[model samples]
Target: MSGRRSPGDGGLYWDEKRGRWIASLTVGYTAGGRRIVKKASGKSKTEAKNKLKEIIRDYEDGLALTSSNETVAEAVRYWLEHGLKGRGDSTVILYTGFANNHVIPAIGARKLKDLSVEDIDRWLAGKARQLSTRSLKIIYSILNRSMRNAIVRDKVKRNIVALCEIPDGCEGRVSKALNLNQAETVLSSAEQADARIGGYIILSLMTGARTEELRKLSWSHVVAFDAEREVWLPVTETGWNHTDYAVYVWRSVRQGGDTKTAKSRRTLKLPQHAVEALRRLWEHEGLDKTDDCAGLGERLVFTTKNGTALSAGNVRRDFRKVIAKAGLTAAEWTPKELRTASCPCCRTPVSPSSRSHAWSATAIRRSPRPSTASRSTP
Candidate 1:
């Protein structure tokens, strides 16, 4: 009597008042124990069934009609609160800042289901004025990943953000390094005044060690060669000057105090200039030799006069002074750039004992490609 139809086939019947065929399906039940029904209307019964099929396709693709009221801000907030499980605190702070400052403020009012390619495009275009291209890309990644998380949880049917292309953003600061001539001036200038910074520049330029790696160097890692025994002994054991020397580069100031990469941990034979500079520092500090390595090795090779660890600010301020002393523009250069300086095989060549380490074996001969690539801008 009633137009109930088969269970999956959906009910089709003529609506006399509207003069149209109406199709309705009792697909399932809602979480609150209410029936979930879908309905469509068309002039013909066939058209009504086809319209019903379209709704089924959308449901199959994970699109939920009830989620239409969920806003983009809600989705972004959900991700910020509960999504980042293993991510670092700094990452959480950074992503939260980006979302709140840049992303959410612009498009957060829109419904998640209604977000479109044009919305994202216009948002990214506006950001181009304020952020660098790299920063824009990062925010774009954050948005795209958030949308992907929403899709997996059935908050949305698909990630339209994935379809959006990143637009070019504002320019960024340029990175550069000293050339060979400038390297000579900095070396000569530092050696005349401060052994700490002198050894820093020589070792950084000669070995290409990162600034963080150098700062974390301890006395125990510095080893002096034993001519008779043919071995490398800690500066803690043998004191500062032996014929040849090397440093065990196993430490850094990275998260958990590990090197940036597995291969970054290495042994580097000191260049003659670096050795002399470190020797001067050892004597200047008047550090005493000790038989117990546990105590002696823990002593940092470089630190503030207060014996605390050096901060980036401390290094940068001192390094700029060194730059000014070298007759170079202090405002234009940085300590990290020393590693990227061209022709590392400056006048104070690596000691003939370079063969002791694998990287140092060819270190004296193979200079990294000219560092002029980054300076192409300014």
Candidate 2:
């Protein structure tokens, strides 16, 4: 019965088809100049008007309305394309694989605004049954990051993934160490291999250096310390001579050539066997005379015959061949296990607290083969 309300006051009308009141308002215009209208329906005029007022208040409060048709897959794709700047290539590849293989195929079709905590929970639980715990964490991180990016872009109001808990997933691979006999066999087999493989195996097994660190080792980082001692000479009273060799584990193949951790950047004294193997490798490669090995000691210690860095796949394939020659199952071994094997080669018993320091000292003292007992004089 009231006079027609002004345009700014909004419009309320009866919908006889559905037997409810409808309220409508134009909040703004789209990029193409199309009117963007907001609508609300209720059983009574007051109820519909209240709903419209709530929407208007939200808009005035800076809440951008998202399209109901925008989907999780679109959000994820947008983040993958725009949000991954400065990330490493391997990391981007891994994230893309998880999204395409696991996330996108599952709940990616769900509307971004309509996605619920229950939906995320169910998806994670299903993934827990098949993927490892580490893998589950990676996928969850991807979803959480994507949703955050969507929120910043006004694609969604909130990130529902923040409310979901990550569940425990399938077990990951277990690492094992070689025993004394196995270590001896591996060393012996490595000694018979090509100079590069033999030197890499000995250095890795004896020094507990990571494969990644070894891959980035440069000749400049190799140092020889000279020891001074007093000698009974007619004219000279002292003599200085080289007593020890050490290698600086200061770089890795990771981005920016940074080690995995600050603690990983250390100087390790080379054991006798390791020094011998390195010497053989240097002579075999003719590094002493090659112009490539001139003033710049930055040349990599381990590489192909053509002086190029070896790929991970190439190293793994060559390592498996060495393992097979040692009479061990190649399927059960990896280059990383050599670090674990170094722990047991220590001659002295190591306390759990001082394992790191004691293990290196032990490796220096003990040889690959068992020592023979000395016979007492009669």
Candidate 3:
């Protein structure tokens, strides 16, 4: 027999500087007659040879063995840079924050190709001790998606993350839904507060509108039925004198001013309290004084005195004040919880199953407001 075992069989040798066994082979020759060599290294000949077999097997199965020696950090950065190309700025910011603060610090130094299911499992398990399950899932997705895209560009052979399951993490903050009594108190307190916040709270708690949706409300969307004209006109056209009123829940503070979903686009009839609150806001705004009621159509319904859109921080701060005034722990509540309690408190006017005052029998009246700014309605 010849010294070489076979033409297609691989060769094994020891690397002097590396002090490891190398399994090397020629898979093909380029058009220029240059030999294309592939390699896999290990501390022992048996380990190197077994890895070489896998590489050869994969190559024969039509997978290219051109993986780079990239680190987890590089892979993650690549995904963060390119993977989220069309995502919203807020979404990108959220993922970037999680990746920097959690994912990279944990396993950024590890080799992408060498990452294993055990590695991912262990990493997620460690994170579970410190993060909430939602946080853990987010970080896991960052790694998992990074490795998956890496495979598309031949950076790695497989994604071990897909094989690993996310472990349960610490408990996250849960939304606290108010019972009937609590809901009543919050509504009453809100009405007694500033008219702007009163309208905000009344609309939020009574209509079950999301905070984003409410913040994006415009005067044009606040429509009132014109009994004579038999058409819905903007609040600016009809003012608050009309009895039948509704709000077009067609916009939100999302990136493009879109509702959360197609189904989220809706029309909500104003409850008695919500109408009172908005009527108070209209008078408090004094657009009629400016004789610019026509121009108020495009103006946002809820905004700061400076006419800027209400931010999440702004809503939270004002909401806490109302909660505190209602004799509840301000720090423990958020604006979203009102949505949960609003479901039954508000019913569609036309729905046969509608029940009146399901949450509070106490009607919401226009609480007296004290503004330094002169009010024309005063």
Best by lDDT: 3
State every prediction's TM-score relative to the real structure: 0.69, 0.75, 0.77
Error of 2 at 229 (Å): 13
Candidate 3 Cα outliers beyond 4 Å, as residue runs: 1-55, 172-175, 254-258, 261-263, 342-378
Q: Whose TM-score is greatest here?
A: 3
Pairwise TM-score winner, candidates 1 and 3: 3
Error of 2 at 270 (Å): 0.6
Error of 3 at 120 (Å): 1.3
Q: What is the lDDT of residue 283 in candidate 3?
A: 84
Best-to-worst ranking by lDDT = 3, 2, 1
Per-residue alpha-carbon lDDT of candidate 2 for residues 353-377, written as tens digits (9 for 90 to 100): 2233322523332222211221111
By TM-score, the candidates rank as: 3, 2, 1
lDDT of 3 by residue, 1-378 (tens): 338647677777889999999988788899999998988899987899898888779878877686588999999999999999878888899999999998899899999878888888888999999999889889999999999989888889888888988889998887668887888789889989988887898788877778998898888778777778667777787677777666777788898778877867766666666777888988898875667686887789999878899988898999899999999999999998887784455423423222332223132232112122211110
Model 1 quality (TM-score): 0.69
Regions of model 1 farther than 4 Å from truth: 1-57, 64-74, 77-83, 88-101, 170-175, 192-198, 254-263, 280-286, 289-293, 298-300, 303-314, 343-378
Candidate 1 residue pairs that clash: none
For lDDT, candidate 1 versus 3, the one ahead is: 3
